[model samples]
Target: MKATTTSAIVLAGGLGTRLRSAVPDLPKPMAPVAGRPFLAHLLDRWIDQGITHFVLSVGYRHEVIRAYFGGTYGGATLDYAVEATPQGTGGGLLLAAQHLPADAPFLLLNGDTFFDVPLSQLTELAASQQTDWCFALFRTSEPGRYMGMEIAQDSRITNLRTGMEQPERLANGGVYIVHPRSLSGLAAQPDTPLSLENDLFPRLLAAGQRWFGLECPGAFIDIGIPQDFHRAASVLPVHTAQRTEDALHH
Candidate 1:
């Protein structure tokens, strides 16, 4: 699929309870990484890949994000989906389903995590897999704090971790390529907040559905906590260099 045809859904509706000390007044997406909001850097990279449409899932202090980004940032068309009540990752994506194209696959990323994977490569892999979903995987030196996935020798995601099992294996980098058909039954239960990691992924695995994972080699950063936020800000140049290299290759 062409980059212009693939829409992006940014899951920005999190409450950011962990990083509230540094960014108490704004949503996580609007929190400053270096001098500008983190979303600015994310959008810049996405635009390099030819993505033009964006659906931002906003919740707490959502007005802050809206006021700053408005309808469009740079050349990307932006749309907002407000979650009156807090929802998990899967729920937030479901809420923004209306803004996505039914025939084309879309990219989804967490507002708090940053990685340097080539979006076009991921898109091509998703199209080739002919599967429901594909996620970007990061092999962290310390996978003790994140969800893990066990992939078969063929690179198919055979299993996913939950509860105590998550910290024991490779971590899940918060990026995904999702087909609209993969989310067919998500909205059936509206009241409960279902997690894409905890609830949805395992179910997909049980049903014998194939999900692909792309192991990224570029720098990965998670700005959900104060320490991580500081580390990411300090390493902004490194991230920029990796992104630039990836763009040139693409």
Candidate 2:
């Protein structure tokens, strides 16, 4: 199946406080990996997956990104949602979403992380379940670092945990297919510094929103820390090229 959701919102506004020692100049996403801006690798993969339009939710040295990839890259139309102040992930997404059509379902990705999920499968799951949100999940023993999720037999997300409370569980991959209607309520809380992982998702889950999860087999890399940032220099180019190769054969 092909992915119908071709537009995406990339959360690219991270301050990269932990990574400032290594990547002092650029925003987290623009930090160089494999001789190219890290964001370029991300966009290249997504564009290969059929994403044609992107709304970058950027702040904290966002100009570096804007000046670098103005309007378009990799055949995708690029748009910017500049945050006057630092809006966290959820708030930045809410701001960027204004650029998309009201009813369309779109992909959401973390700019600092690369999860090589099959975008078509994400859209397929959402369409089949008639769900508002579908998360691409990965099994992780180190759940302390990421959001731990409990998924039911039917793939409905039943619970969420913050830390190692649930070790060796399915963790959020920072990749999702989300409909705008599911996030419409958040539009009201524009000024609040809402986090997609820490704040908004928990609220939506409690509200009995239609949320599901699918475990994906893919290379997942988060360059939020210095170690991973360095690791990406070796991992990203090979993994992304493999992705393009896999896409071609399929």
* Global lDDT scores for all candidate models: 0.77, 0.86
Per-residue CA lDDT of model 1 for 1-250, tens digit only, reads 6533357899898999999998888888878876678877787777767888899988888898887777877667899988888877778888888788777788888888888778877777787788678888877656357777787776678877643333345567888888888776658245788687777777777887768888877678888988888888765542344333223322
Model 2 lDDT per residue over 1-250, tens place: 5669999999999899999999998899989887678888899889888999999999999988987788877668999999888789988999999999999899999999999998888899999897888999998887489988888999999998778555488999999999888987666254678788888888888888899999998988999999989988666645435333223322
Model 1: lDDT to the true structure: 0.77
Please identify model 2 stretches exceeding 4 Å from their true place.
165-167, 188-191, 237-250
TM-score of each: 0.88, 0.92
Cα lDDT for residue 92, model 1? 86
